[model samples]
Target: MVILGLGSNLGNRAIHLKRAISRLSRGSGAVLHAVRLSRIYGSPALTPTGAPAAWDLPYLNCALLGETTLEPGALLRHVQEIESSLGRQDHRRWAPRVIDIDILWWDGCEIKSDDLTIPHPEILKRPFVLEPLRDLIPDTILDSETVEAHASRAGARASVGEIAHSPDADIDVSYPTLMGILNITPNSFSDGGRFLEPETALMHARRLVEEGAGIIDVGAESTRPDGATIDPATEWARVEPVLHGLRALQGEVRSLGRRDPFQISIDSRNPSTIRSALDIGVDILNDVTGFTQPEMLEIAESTDVPLVFMHSLSIPVVKGESIPPDRDSVEFLISWAEERLAEFDRRGIKRHRLVFDPGIGFGKTAHQSWHLLEHVERFHDLEIPLLVGHSRKSFLRTVTEKPSAGRDVETLTVSRGLVEKGVEILRVHDVEGHATLVSRHHSDRLSQLDAGAAVKP
Candidate 1:
């Protein structure tokens, strides 16, 4: 079954949405099983420049469930076509629209691409989404925390009056327990240009696997805040060798008796890159952009690949030389990221395939990173798997009184702490050390559980 979330805040909002859903139901290879409407939410528009601007419109949201033979991406295109027919195009950032049809989740599939990101990126943050979602899936928990807990944190600033779903269908997803960070830039402060050397990158890959990494991430560009930027060709060059090595490593690891070692993730915000990676054997995509761009969601909706939809505070450059990452902006980093993540979920992308990240050092100060970690559990309510890469990060060194290059112990220690806070992946250089520690601890726990279950039972 696929869940489609609908929204509108323009002329004949309700009618526009009805026409869109009706078109969807009457369209090909899809059936409408359930529909849920939340109380209309009227709030000022949120512009890219970070001010409460006027959309001169109201927003109405709803949830829908159905089964479809059309692949998730195809279905997404179909939805976009409907929106276009209903007259929705780029006018303003949060300007009113006639109708928006977003596929939140497609059964148990995960997709990441330029055109679409399943689970609609904005679902997590908007009360407009959660309210209707709760109406239908009251017992369904999307975050690690319970639904009530997730709701309570939503506060009253956002208004989403609860509406009802007619004979609500069962919506559920069992998430995989793995997260992989794919940093693409050669200048990413964390890894530097190490992965640029394919051989050296393969070594890191091997170490991750030996250390219990379930996925090997491949990035072709960098999004480090206030960090050096590169062109697409440059980004491609950086990741191409490593990507080839990664594919070969798949076979190499298999030959070494570690079959199905780990999935490969393409870390990129560019749709072109997403297309290029998928052309190869890339298994997943991790986009740092909030997926506010309709094209981004369009790319993801066009495929069924797993996606890691991140939360960032700002709208990234569409196609320009972005200024380097901010080295000393904590609130700018955390709050922006928090809002981005929530908005991304609200827009599209399912909660299951959707892994969240706390941007760590990107656009963040060292102290901010520490504060984010301190309240990292707050993100657990999103229910998506968390990926924190403190490996050789400045934060690790800050706490350890060492530089980023010589802080393996600090990195490992932070990794341990983050995992306890529900982080699923630790993107780091010292994978072997971290993996070995985690594996041993896990092994002992299993042993203890086995011993307890076996004795006199």
Candidate 2:
């Protein structure tokens, strides 16, 4: 029997442990079967005097007892790969991490190598590891004492408790959420002039919510390359009626017993339009222009709502003179986004409430847009949830010989890739397709969790 201790002290601790367990169950050189697992425990930080401040966070630790055909050294390599895949980084000892996996014991076999040591040197002395290991393997003997005895002896020194992962605990990152597009403008490239009327727009918004859209992005003006921009007053007039209707819909959904109401986002760059939408209580502001205006920053400072700053070299809806010379699209995007984010920091906007969109088709050439999508994971360094609006953009049109409406398949294809790369919010035109895809993905994870939870002592 192989036993591994898993722990995480940063960023959704429970999800990290569960994710590691799930990955380990899959093949890693040799097939590994999860024989039994222990309940997740929240433990106090193991901070010595010389530990860094990052070790201040508490850790969620658990133990997994499994059967594997691979030898100890090979298994150690596999576990290290899994840790790095789940966002663990090389940092100082006792530093907080996204996930940490240690080979507590391997088949009662003792092995020593430069890279790893069997029966972890201090495993018996640590209550966090011993407690969970004892639960899975009740009679497990470590060093000269039984697992239970070691845990009992050190239990008084450690603060630990059983905890389960919430259904929505990993909602922000584990699963890709669909943000349905609700363009209320008459000049938008897709769905423009379709739902300009208040009732029609409201009906479509309701349909989006019913179809499993976590967010409904109601854009007043078109941000297409060849679209025209209206003044703030004209823009607000277009979206005002629809906003009022959706505000009422929010109450209706809540009265009908929905716990977390669907979020509504205003997709515009004008300060006046943002102010009007905020006055009517919009949940998020998605500025395609990166929120560069002084008044826009002022509004962000005064409001506590989440804001999305899309990366674009020029203002939306207006065609740029020419595409920039070929270069590393990921580097360019990161640099541009970082500079914009620094401005937000100076404006006193909270980083926790900030979301970054890569601006798929805002101003880039067809090649540039595809390059950005291909390497979307590069933006995870921003350390926040990413919003990808790849719903029927010009990039798809260039790849496939299809019109705007016919590119839903391409959009779905890209959406699946983004979902796999940990893209959180996907703004799409086809809510049902994206929602169904994400729903099934989340369900598979849930099933794995259910199966793991069933593993007891």
Candidate 3:
């Protein structure tokens, strides 16, 4: 096992760290295979006495855990080459640089050489290093104490901040945002009849927001295979009151000083329902049928709101129907998405306003769903946002044998894997559980790091 510390204080710091990790994963004849990455953190630069003010710029830092086939010395030289390739220049100690890679630990091996050292000398004394190191190997022993213990002590004395979502940061490095599911149908597969009443639905929407949902996907008609189909008027009836209540709720939330209020997405495929939702001022449109309908295409052309285009074989999916056995599911979805993008482009609909969902569990067997998820990275080639709605789906229930309402844990497990693959959004039933998982994985120990203090070295 190998652990490396990465930091950047100059020139698009997040990009620098991302590029370094990419290069390390592929360079050196494939010597380093990254297995995990710590959440990115922001910290003040460690500068020498009498250094220029420009050298004191803050840094974005993270830790990478991986396996290496090369020895410690050879690994050191390779990383140094990577640093230089990313525009790091030989400069004075603690000087601001484009990128910095330090070999923090190498399989408990101890060595002290002129060029490199195993188990970085200041791991225990630096919060920036200890915090991210603990993220990867919390219980591993370091100088007679666990990495977690050292991190606690170091954090108690130092100031570190998580790299929170900002306008300029690349979405690839940002944590996956949550879209809480709000099904207001009596016969939906999960939580059926629970929020059929408009009042109940509004309360649940508020709860979802409190639980950390950045978007509330309100769907009146359930699209599950066994779900009952409803007309546009019926769907609008179920959804209208909830929409008004949500607008009022948004006003309430905004009055409380929340700068970025949660967005509202209407999840439906019916044209009338979507038109009514647009008239009601919803922020996004989620179509389960992938906009195959002509009226849906007309709506897309008329609206500028972000649209979620899901790939499914049929609405309220037909059982025993799925991608052909001989077809590659991932490739099939990619082709489908490309064709959709082309059609939208030809119609003058901007590509940037689009998102794709592989439509897990819709017209797919358990095995097919899992296969598509495993290779979801292929969809990134589309260069648009991806939203995955794997929450409480039958595919997960196959593994845990849990009912729809009981599959939150399974949903989170899969959601974490999606987050690692850089999926932009996760549409989920349990917003709180998924939120906690993302917080721990992407911002572990952020509270301590964000506290105003300095490492007592």
Candidate 4:
């Protein structure tokens, strides 16, 4: 395990840092696969006592935890080459540069050499380093104190520098993709009986697309614990008309000169319903059962659409059930996802088309669900896109005490956190609210980046 500290203060700092990360991940002959990335921290640049005022520009800093096959010396040389490629020049000490990558820690080894140092000598004194390091490993013991403890102490010092922007303030970053929910069932949890009619569902689908949904995940069966269990025929009956209506709507949009409009996804576990939806034309398949059944796998093998394999212990999700207490939630989830990926690979399904969902509120206690949200970054190690559907679920009620309809505020709040943690897609009910949240966040990030770029050295 190695932790590398990255920072930049000149010429679009976010871009520099991102480019450096990309280069580092592809080290020549020595693979450096980043497993976890800390939240990007913006701090005032550190300069020498007699340095020019122009050198004190604010910098975007972050730490990356990764695994590598190279030794300390080779790794240092590799990063130095990456730095040179990214336009890093070492003309003077503490000088502003396009990129800076330092090996912070390397497999708990303590080494002192003329070229490199393990456990960076100034790691404890620099709050910018500690702040992001704490995000990756809060409880790591350093200098006989936890990283979190050191961060707190360094943070209290007035000279440590103020945080200027949130982690998502990057001009080149991809914002969270929105998956709009269209429930055709009359007993769905959040909007049950609201859009049961085909016309109403079609209108709502159009509204969702207008509000910024890249995909509309249409479901005809309610998967809630106490919800009714319908047969494949009943499910298809509810779903068929909506699919046709959506296709017609797509045609209408294209006729009006709209090209490559929103995608359509079927959110059902029933094999019959899945086949019918795919027969008509659905861009994605969202299996709440995680494709455990042979028929579901057969359908997956037949189609090339992206598959959302959500983790659930049961279909309806028995109430009061949760992952075993002895097992770690994040580890369990990653393991389950890995197994699914392996299964898909053995069956000749392209692994790249798979997306994993933690299945929040399904067979999980409120606390367990919240814990998964807090440590959501761990799932990124799977190297697959993630989709989270925490929209107005029972978990939010644990804190907001609001019913399904009233949890939009809480839903938006949690969605923001999830976006910050770098989740790829968000399956949401309130498309407008999530859309507004995403738009505002992107606008703020652009403003910050613009301000940073305007700074003259």
Best by TM-score: 2
Residues 258-339, candidate 2: write the lDDT tens digits. Answer: 5457888999899888898899999999988788888888889999888999977666545653246566877888888889
lDDT of 3 by residue, 280-352 (tens): 8898999999998999999999988888999999888888899987888888888988899989988988765
Candidate 3 residue pairs that clash: 157-454, 157-455, 158-454, 158-455
TM-score of 1: 0.52
RMSD values for the candidates in order, in angstroms, are 18.6, 9.5, 9.9, 13.2
Candidate 1 C-alpha lDDT tens digits along 381-421: 44344577556765565657766667878766776666554
Model with the higher lDDT, candidate 2 or 4: 4
After aligning candidate 3 to the native by TM-score, how far in Å is the CA of 414 from where it should be?
1.1
All candidates in order of lDDT, best leading: 4, 3, 2, 1
lDDT of 4: 0.79
Residue 125 displacement in candidate 1 (angstroms): 45
Q: Order of all candidates by TM-score, from best down to worst?
A: 2, 4, 3, 1
The C-alpha stretches of model 3 lying farther than 4 A from their native spots are 1-173, 445-457
**Considering TM-score, which of the candidate structures 2 and 3 is the better prediction for this target?**
2
User: What's the CA error at residue 226 for candidate 2, in Å?
Assistant: 2.0
Which residue pairs in candidate 2 have backbone atoms (N, alpha carbon, C) closer than 3 angstroms, thus clashing? none
Count residue pairs with overlapping backbones in model 1. 49
- What's the true lDDT of residue 266 in model 3? 95
